[model samples]
Target chain A: MDKRILVIEDEEIIAEYYKKILQNAGYEVAIFYNGNDALQYYRQFHCPVVVTDLEMPQMSGEEVIGNIKEIDDDQVIVVVTSYYDPATIINIMKKNVYDYIVKPIEPVEFGATIKRAFESAEYRKMKKALEQERILKLERQIEWFNWHESIIQRNYDRVDRELFSNLHESFNQGAGFGSLLTLIRLIASMAKKSNGNYVIDEQMFELIKKNADVAEKILNIFSELVIIMNRTFEFEKVSVMELHSLLRMIIAEIEKYAGIKKMKIALSEQKPPYKSAYVNIESDYIKKAFHEIFMNALKFSKPSTAVMVFVDMKTEGVEILIINTPEIIREGVVGIPVEYENLLFEPFFRIAKVVYEEFETSDYGLGLTLVEKIVRKHGGSISIANILDSSDISRASETKVCVRVWLPLASEASRGERKGA
Target chain B: MDFKKAAESMQLPLDDYLSLVQKFLERLPQYREGIFSAKNSGDMKRLAAEAHKLKGVALNLRFEELAECAKKIEIIAKGEAQIADDVFGMLEHLIMEIKQLMLAKENRDG
Candidate 1:
């Protein structure tokens, strides 16, 4: 608990009176002659309780209260004024000020009011902490529910039937179903005919190779899904790295993919101060997360346009924004509308069909969902939004999709080292 | 003025009460000049503000008559009441009387 109280009063006599009384009551008191100076001090070092005189020179006490509340809405303020009008008191109370004391104050009553204000501040702090914990618990519950729902909703059966039916059709038009058993019997018959030679004709070998490739691809997807669902990373594997350097590396790795789509990955230049912004992460998992984001950006971007990447430093974290002008913009086309933004990270909720090589596979829509899980496991957050172009005269155009990821900054020591390096 | 009763009402020891009174008297000329200047300049807002300050300190120190006089000036300057021609003169006389009373008490204590 902070025992410091800030007293803002223009009258030196009154200020000194407050200081003396509060100090005698065992509170550390800081006195400012005006609201401006008091607020300036408050921005740097916050005192839980503020006692302000409503009439002051540079900034009125009401302005002071409003500004302080802007900085921290829960800041406890007690207004001290010489005279009070009922309307004035009502207006100040609307600002959520704890209480106001009319001057010519009774000392004991003044002290008691201050005590109650501190108690309220303490209670507010506890309530905020509890609320945050509750939110975190609810988020975890939602994640669990979504994971189980994806599994229980017959996603595996649907994917299996679709893939087997497609493979059966490709093998032969009349190979109705049970494609796996038919293919296995075909392989065994071929092996028996080879009879220790294991030789096959060129056309037969090509057909088997194509089927094997598709099977391997499906196996890989399911393997990744299982790993994401079950694995917990070891904390010891986490390392601190400058975010700009990591982003530059990711961009370098994905530039080839972007180039294949006739798109460019343009990374913003790292400013000097923010070059030292470091984050603690399991580099491989974080790399995979950004790779998924960049790949999605490239896959959806318009030809010859740039997928822009920006890294910005926030108060307690670093934010990465990936912006791309998408290729699809027509009504009812494959685009994330504002209303559907929250569902973008839900498992198996893909909005667009991605064409791989010459065919479109059931994409499972887990790219972003997996990325979200990885980021959240490392105590970061990810969100996507469709940016609308309001500058157009005729209609609002959905111009771009922005994927933002925020990761908590590493310790000061790591940042200092990066700066030195 | 009853010094004992005023000090008791302020919940201050006699010595502490006398010290605060001395401090108030030291600031008396500045307070008087501020009110007089605001009134002469026809800046009723400043006049009301100055009077409000004086009224607050006087009330806190249990200077009942002085507080009442300052309050009237504040109300009149705020345009809530009509200003009397003799009000300023009355305020000056009350201030002088308080100063004399403090001086007499100081001499008697020494």
Candidate 2:
């Protein structure tokens, strides 16, 4: 095709000079003295190659080029400037030029430069089409990721809440296992990532559990989850303060949900003295296990009652007790730990009938089994006993079921007085 | 006692423990001060960040004893945990130990 070209130069010599070169190169050429004239011609001809001087009286090359582009984006143009300034360069870039030349020009270089410009314009168009395709591909991936994130997040939120009240009702006698709750809160958040992976890796656990303070909490969290996963486990030692702060962050993150569910939790002492307590376990496992337990408890229990969890001092160490009125234990799961029966901590082992009925939605019978395993790993025992019997005079069944978890699971403690594990 | 002097007196590496001690001492004035000054600041989010940072440094250094003290300050800073006279007492003990360590080092070096 005989490409149409426009020459816009303020100097007579440069204008005539461009017309000669483009004409020699087999282009149909038009020449003009000012930006206004070129633009006027441009609007009429819609020439693709409009070579123009940057400095002009009637209108600047930049303004002319901008208008040309707004009119037709595919138009290719070259700018000629006398002196190059940073602003001019930026302005040129913004104006979207094919190529630009400084004065005291070389004819051959200018031709080659213009040729390169045309090639690049073609290249850029191709690249733009390519980039758009890439974005669409990325959009698909993003859409998929967002879908998974939402599902995981929803489950994460729901499970964390369930753990809170359920743990309170089961272990705490209305109030005190603040530190234990802090630890449980963290594990609950981790456990809620339904689509993600959590493992009870021993080495990572050993390193994490070097600190004495948070070891028990970590152990408790991981132990619970490990049982849920039905796997071998190790306890880790990360700071309880970090864990608790994480909890606070999670609480703050899901502040809306807690408010919605009217779920609330308070530390036994408000400000527990032990921030750097040890959680002798893997974080992910503990979090998952504890969250599952709480979720079931909350779902299965009667709402509107404060599920209280508190830590009390025991002669052996600390006792983190999750006291809840189970009011219902279906005979079978926690039944005398019979044949392989030692496997109550297995995934989906709901000892209490209330659990199955309540958490019928996620029929995964592995929450309490996990809690049992988690408690055992901490070298502690969890007993699901009755507190208030169903006072039906004829039936005379226990009304309140107390799942008193005599956890070494005691709450936060003072420095240097750690109970021997 | 000055921490630097304590390390020097005890023949402990002055620079070795100074940074850790320096980090701890940075918050001494905070524990002594007893209250965060951003009274109108809606919450202690920033303070919590600061406290979180202190905890990492405190625990990593294996300054278990000192770390315990910093944890208290962190709680108070968190607004959920309050600072008490005992927290100051712990901070004071850490400062005194570092100072004594420095003094012991200085005496040995001298």
Candidate 3:
């Protein structure tokens, strides 16, 4: 009984044609002879379905629809128009109406259309009700968490402090040497099992053990940096570090997070003589900067795509390119508009077309902004660009977006060493 | 055209259906006047709009001949069909036929 249909038609007889059939079907029906009255009635009564003729006096059907959608984005409207061309019809379909009927419709077809509109409206109402309920529950949970956040934070901080301190002490004392060696031996045996043709000779085992030691030392260096970063914010010391090793370590850590989504991280091999280039950077700040940039590449890319990191040296500085395919943007889902290219680096700015429900707990649109700030602090520049090609039609969906970073080369350290020599 | 059958199919009474026909007959003169003024001023957009409305209304009332004439005029005025000077004359002829039928029906019923 609550279900109602509003019919808006300029022609009185055609309006009556709809009214007679709809009213006989045991549904409440209201007739408006013009779009203005229809819109006013819609604002007042909010009918579940609207059957409107496309042409009317004082207001066209398109204008009425646009205005009504402004009021209620989910309103279901069925357009009935006698006049249309191929182009006009295509444009009308893109307006996102419920359905459309040409002139000279029979009673049966009209009745079926009404029935479908009613069913769709009911379904939408049910979904909206459920969504509202879920939102209410989440709000309550968030409120409770906010109330107890201080205590939760204090306990988490205590656990982190104790864990990293013990971790730093173990590395300093070389306490895990025996366990590390045993783990390396286990890996070598597993490799031998996987490849039955390979011989389990002592010489090969020695080589594996040597490689494992190098890995452990690199890991210990990373652990030390994490410990110092946690303890203080000041950049205490600047040292020359291998750029590729730093990048490789950060990529390995980030790969663990991407593993949940089956994503891949790839680093292009640095060509010949420049394979192991060094940069003089504060250990903590450089690690933080790389972590922030790499994690963003992981977060924004589709789960199936690979994130690529390419490094090379330029006359001006060391250039790093982080490239990945962004989530495919469809018609309704909000995407980053080209006009917002520069604005994306502004603090707290987020793309309008992002599906908020999909990324409900993502960073407060501050990841890119933070990366930009840190890059600028380190005398570096970062720019974002859409990678597209007009020549390849097949690669349209794989449009790669690249974030490029250029950091000033640490020439001072190299110059000081040369002078000492 | 069968007014009784049209009304029955619509689930409407014969009296209500005849009243709709009478209302359409009453508005014919104003529609003709508007179409003439639009044509005189070379307002094809206005002519197309008027003719499109007429076409829909005529079909609903089972004025088949009038509806066909209005449909032609509508397409021509909207520049969808080739413009022929005879279309206006054809619409006028159909309007006269409808007026004659309405007068005859009213006389017989009265």
Q: What lDDT score belongs to each candidate, Candidate 1 first?
A: 0.74, 0.51, 0.68
Instruction: List ranges where model 3 is wrong by over 4 Å.
Output: A141-421, B9-11, B80-85
Off by over 4 Å in 1: A136-421
Question: Model 2 segments beyond 4 Å from truth?
Answer: A1-234, A239-267, A270-279, A313-315, A325-361, A389-399, A406-421, B1-110
Q: Which 10-residue window in model 1 chain A sums to the lowest lDDT?
A: A170-179
Best first by TM-score, ranked:
1, 3, 2
Which candidate number has the best lDDT? 1
- The CAPRI category of model 2 is incorrect
Interface RMSD of 3: 1.8
**What's each prediction's clash count?**
0, 82, 1
Which candidate's DockQ is highest?
Answer: 3
Model 2, A362-391: lDDT tens digits are 333445666676666656677543233222
**How much native contact recovery, as a fraction, does model 2 achieve?**
0.00
| Global Cα lDDT for candidate 3 | 0.68
Sequence-dependent TM-score of model 3: 0.46
Chain B alone vs. reference chain B, TM-score for every model = 0.96, 0.50, 0.88
- Reference-based TM-score, model 2: 0.27
